[model samples]
Target: MATDPYADPKLEGVSIRSLPKVSLHDHLDGALRPQTIIELADEIGLDVPSTDAEELADWFEDQSDSGSLVEYLKTFDLTTAVMQSADGLRRVAKEFVEDLAADGVIYGEVRWAPEQHLGGGLSLEEAVEAVQEGIEEGEDAVDRSGRDIRVGQLITAMRHADRSLEIARLAVAFRGRGAVGFDIAGAEDGFPPSRHRAAFDYLASEFFPVTVHAGEAAGLDSIRSAILDGRALRLGHGVRIAEDLEVVQQQGDSVLVTFGDLARWVRDREIPLELSPSSNLQTGAIAAWGKNLEDHPFDLLYQLGFAVTVNVDNRTMSRTSLTRELALLAETFDYRLEDLEAFQLNAAAGAFLSVEEREELIELIGEGFDA
Candidate 1:
C-alpha cells in the first residue's frame, strides 16, 4: 500500500487517506504547495502576502472563507501570478499530482484555464505542453516510489473572457497528448455558460467531454444553461441543484421530496455532482442549506439518488484533500466504507476516460476498499 502523508481522521479505525479516491474537480493553479508559491513568487519577483509558508497557507484559508465565490477567487491572483512561466507551471503541476498521490488518489483530473497562464510569453500550445510534461514526470515519480497514479488535464477557459472558442480549440488540439476534457470556470453568476455558445458548439461538434462550473455561485438558470447550451457532461460543484428539490417530509434518511425538472433530469440521468464539502462552505455554495458541514445537502442529494461525488476544489485555498473531504463527510453523516466507495465509483463512472479504463478504475476502488 502507498503511504499517505496526510493520513488522519480514521473511519472505522481505517485511515481515510489509505483508501482509493478519485478527484474530478481539482484545480491545478489552486493546489500549489505554499512553499512552491513562495519560491516561484520570489523567482518571478512577485510580492506575496506572506513570505512564510505557514502564514501563506493561513492567508489563503482566511481569504477563502469569506462566504462569496468572487472574494474566494481573489486569492488565486497570487498563485496564478507566479504560474506565468513554463517552469512555474511545470513545477506546480508536478507537485499537484505528487500531493494527490500521497493523499491516495488513484486517478485525478487537474483542471485549469490555460488562458490564465499566458502572461509570461508562453503560447497556448507551449503552456499545455509544459503542464503535460509535469504531469508525466509526476506519474513517473509515483511509479518510482512503488505506487501508481494517473492524472489528466482538463483545459479550462474563463467564462468571463471571450476566449472560450480559442481555448476550446486549444483543448481539442491537445487531445490524447495530456488534455482529457474542457471546462469554463470563473464567476458563474453573471457569466452564464450561454455566453460561450460558440465554444460549446465547437466542442459538441468535436464530441469532446465537458464539465462546466455552474450551480456554485449561481442558481438553477446557470446550471440549466450549462446543460442546454454548454452540454456539460458533468457539473462542477452542482450543489445548488438542490434548490430545485422541494422537501415535503423528512425523518433521518427517509425523506419525500418533489424534484424540479432540472433536479429530476440530473438525478434520473445520473449526472455527477462534483460536491466539495469545505470549499462549498467557504464559498457559501451551501449557504442555502446551512452554515456548517452538517448543513450540506450532500446527504440529502445522495439519499435522493444524485450521482454525488466528493471533491477538493481548491486544496490550498480550502486546506483540504480528498482524504480530508471524505473524513468530514463520514463524520458528519456517519457514512461507512461502502458509502465512500460508492462516491469513488460514481466519480470513476463520470471520468472522461474510455469505458474500459473506468471499469479498471472501478475494480481498483473495490479492491482497495475491500482490503
Candidate 2:
C-alpha cells in the first residue's frame, strides 16, 4: 500500500487522532489487528493468507481493491474464521475498543452477526456474552489510561439467512446487557430489508433500534425498504441515497440540486446516513459517482442537510480508522476543524444512547475540539 496522508499526520496543528469522534457503522469482524489475527489463527490451526502481519494486512487491502463485491466479501471469510472461538472473539472485541479509544473515539457501536460466530459450537447467547466481556475489559483498560470509551453490540442477522426473527429476539434480549441495537447485514441487492419484515416487526414492537445495510450494493428501493420495513433509524452506508438526488449544477463552493421524495424525507427527518469513505470506494459502493474520495457525494449530502456521519466500515480491509477517514475527507474537501467537529456532533447525536448520555458526548466532543 502507498502512503496514507493521515496515517499519523496532524491537522490544523492538532493531531486528528487527538480530537474526539464517534463511530456508528464500524464492524467487529472488520477491525481486528493483523497481529491479533495471526495469533488467533495459529491457536485454531487456521491458515491465513500470510504469516507476517504486514503481509497479511497487504493481502487484505489487495483483495478488497479488486472492486468486485464478491472479492470484497471474501475478506470477511478470513476474519470471521478465526473469530469463532470465545478467546478469539473476546480478544478481538477488547482490541476493537482499545483501537477506537486510541483513535480518539469517545463512543462507538461495533456491529456483527452473532450467528456467524457459532461455527465453534458456541450458542448465540454465548457469542454475545463473550464479546461483551471483552468490551468491558477494554473499557476498563481505556479508563485506566485516563480516557473514557464505551462500546455496544449491534446484533446483526445475515439478510440472506432465515434467522432474522431469531436474531431480532436475541438483540432485544441482550438490551441493557451489552447489545444496544439490531441490524440486518449481508448481500443487500436481492435480500432487501423487506425480506425480514417479521424481524423488523418484532423489533419495532419491542421498541428496539434497528439499522439496515441498504443503499450500498443496491439503490433507492433498498433504502426505502430499509426505512419502511426495517424501521431503521439509521442506514448503514446509505451512500446510495445520493441516487435520489438530481444535481443540477456545481457553482463555486455551491451546488444546485433537486431531491426525490425519498431523499427529501431522509434529509428532513434527519435519518442518519452512516457513510464510510474508504470502504465505499473499495466495495464499489460509490462507483457510480467516481473513483476518488473527492467524487464521493459526502460533501453534497452534508451541504444538503442530510444527517451524514463518517465511518470506517472495515478497518483492516480498508486499512483506515475514523481518524484517517476524517483526515482524507478534510484533504479532499479542504474541511477545517469546525467541519470535522460537525461530523462528530452528528454522530454523537445519532448514537444509540440515552438522550442525556448523547448530550454528555456532545459536550465531551465540544471540550475535546475546543481544547
Candidate 3:
C-alpha cells in the first residue's frame, strides 16, 4: 500500500479505482461536491462555513472527524437546505452520478430522506421526481461522455419523524421510476426500527426492499429490530454486529471465535454489512472493537465468511470515496486485488436491484477485474 492514502493502487497492474464497482450505502447529502454546495447555498440564501470549495471541503472533514454524530448530521442541514428545491435536487443528483462515474462506480443507489426536502413547499412526489430527473440526466451525461453508469434512488424516512408511513408510500409509489428501495436513517440509537413498524409493514406488504440504519449507533438489539421488525434486507452500517461474536482464542495470525445467534444468522444468510471504515471510526460505530481502521471489524467479518462490503456512508463528512475506503482497508488489512474484488461482488449481491440487474452488475465487475 502507498503512503498516499488517496492514491489509486495497481493490483496486478490495474488501478483499483478503475475497477468496476457497486455502491449500496452511499448517502445523497453525504456525496455532494463542495462547489455544488456553495452554489446551492447561494441559491437558497443559506450561510455555509466557507465560500471556497476547498475550504468548505476541509471544514466538512474537520467537523465530521469531531467524533460526534450530532455535529456530523449538522452538515446535512446545509445540504438538505439547498436540496429543498427541485432544481437543487436534480443538480445534486446529476453531479452525484458524475462523481460516482469518475470514481469508477458502474452502479449506485443514492439514499436520502425525502421527507426532509418538503420544507421548500415541494410535495413528497415532486421531491422524488426531481431526484429521479437528476439521476436520469446524470446517466445521460455519463453515456454522452462514453462512460456507462446506472443509479437508483433509495427513498428514506427519518427515524425520529412520525411520517415513515408517508415516506414508505412515497417509495413504493415510485417503484419502477428511479426508486429501488426504502430505508430509515437518522439518529439510530434512540429511534429503533421498531418505531417505524407501520412503514416497514407497508413496505413489506408492497414487496419493497428495505435497508435499515442499525448497529452503527446502537448494538445487537437495534440490529435485531432492524431485521425482525424493519424487515431489512441489508444493514446500513451494521459494523457493530461484531459485538455478537465472542473471541475465544488468539495465536499469532489465527483466532477462534464464536458467533451469537444474531451474528450467526446475519453471516449465514449473507446479509451485507455496509462497512464504511472512516465513517465507522469517526462516528464511534466501531468503538467496541477499536478506534482505528485496523481496529475495524471489517477484516474479521470478511475472514469469517460474513458478507462485508466496503462503502463511504457519508463521502463529504468522511472526506472519502469508495476507492479511498477500499484503499484504507487494503492498507489496514494487507488486502490485494482478490480482496477488493470480493468486496465489490458482495456489494453487487446486496444491491437493491432485481436479481437480474444484480447479475448484470456482477458481470461488469468480473469483466473489469479481469481486465
Least accurate stretch of 10 residues (summed lDDT) in model 1? 1-10
lDDT of the candidates, in the order given: 0.93, 0.93, 0.89
Over the stretch 1-371, how does candidate 2's per-residue lDDT look in tens digits?
56767767688899999999999999999899999999988998989989999899999989898765667888999899999988889999999999999998989999999999999999999999999999999999999999999998999999989999999999999999999999998888888998899999999999999999999999999999999999999999999999999989988887899999999999999999999999999988999999999999999999898899999999999988999999999999999999999999999999999999999999999999999
Cα-based TM-score, every candidate: 0.98, 0.98, 0.97
User: Which candidate number maximizes TM-score?
Assistant: 2
Summarize candidate 1's per-residue lDDT along 1-371 as a digit string, tens digits.
33444457688788888899999999998999999999998987888889998889889999999999999999999988998999988889888889999999999999999899989999999999999999999999999998989999999999999999999999999999999999999998899999999999999999999999999999999999999999999999999999999999988768999999999999999999999999999999999889999999999999999999999999999988899899888888999989999999999999999999999999999999999
In model 3, how large is the Cα lDDT of residue 361?
A: 88
Candidate 3 lDDT tens digits, 80-183:
88888899999999999999999899999999988888888999999999999999999999999999999999999999989999999988989999899999
TM-score of 3: 0.97
Per-residue error (Å), model 1, residue 356: 0.5
Model 3 RMSD in angstroms: 1.9
Instruction: Compute the lDDT of residue 326 as modeled in candidate 3.
Output: 80
How far is each candidate from the true structure, as Cα RMSD in Å?
A: 2.4, 1.2, 1.9
- In candidate 3, which residue pairs get closer than 3 Å at backbone N, Cα or C atoms, i.e. clash? none
Better by TM-score, candidate 3 or 2: 2
The CA lDDT at 77 in model 3 is 82
